[model samples]
Target: MGSLLFLAFAYLAVGQAAVNRNGAQTAADAAALAAAQDKRDQLAGKWVEEVLDPTQWQDIFDGFAPGLTPSCWRADQLASQNDAHVDGCVPGPLEFEVSVEMDNPVGDSIIPGTEGRYSTESAIAVIEPRCTFELPEEDAGDDVLPQLTCKDRNWDLDPEDLGDLPAPEDLFDVHLAD
Candidate 1:
């Protein structure tokens, strides 16, 4: 009977550790995605600002827009929301890598040294530009812009109208890197 009880406790301890590890990974994934999404939003905004200038569209889609801000703060906020803390946030060309540690350690368990153990995990999220536009063959004037095709959806953008602009999600896709 004592042996069975010990085995049960051992299983419980392993389950506890697994849960904590999963939580850490979840937090890291959320943090990385948040950072990438933030940058995607910023780029979309920049595109709107330069809508009339088709020459700048390629640069914007490539994630090299001017006046863009760092997105790591978003990672921190997301980690906190997930009951974790971001240990590192690194921004690359079009991706963000984040490492998170669980805010709470594994609770006291039958296994020794489990109470002080915290789980840390890392994830990478990428921002991929979804829109492609070909400059008009002829000068369409400042009031008109080229049609943009994003993820099979076409956007007929008009600088003068400015009401039906593509949203941030339409311009870029944010996903966890595998």
Candidate 2:
């Protein structure tokens, strides 16, 4: 009976450790995914209005750079896109880049340089996703596989991604001297 008690306590301690670790992982994944998508949305909105220059890239890191959001995961300041400028400043002028990756559905849209600013294709991929709980089907028989249901509550984009513009800029040239 004493041995059984010891075994029980050991089991409980190990289970607690495993659970704590998994919780940490979930938080980290959530934060990473959120930061990537959030950054993308911000860029998409600013793309049409202002060019993503060196300064602009710096702005991307802003206050969101460090630690995890309310959702967890680690966020850090990404360097400017110009590979030539390792110091975040380029001599031949600076440009933005797709440093962050996500499960983008709109595809890679690279904004071009027209008046010191250019466009970049947005990439959407499920960088981080929410938790999905699955249950086993009870109708499985011998040599039969049980069907599992998958629920996707993860992934997101900024409101700017859905912004309404007069028209697609690529379709025509409308220059403003602001």
Each model's C-alpha lDDT? 0.92, 0.28
- What is the lDDT, from 0 to 100, of the residue 56 in candidate 1? 98
Q: Highest TM-score among the candidates is held by which one?
A: 1
After superposing candidate 2 on the true structure, give the runs of residues whose Cα lies further than 4 Å from its correct spot: 50-178
lDDT of 2 by residue, 1-178 (tens): 9989877866665564454444433333333334444433433344334321222323322322222222111122221211111111111111111222221122121222222322222211132111122222445322332121123222121333434322222211211111
Clashing pairs in 1: none
**For candidate 1, lDDT tens digit of each residue in 19-53?**
99999999999999999999999999999888889
Candidate 1: C-alpha lDDT? 0.92
Displacement of residue 31 (Cα, Å) in model 2 is 1.4
What TM-score does each of the candidates earn?
A: 0.93, 0.32
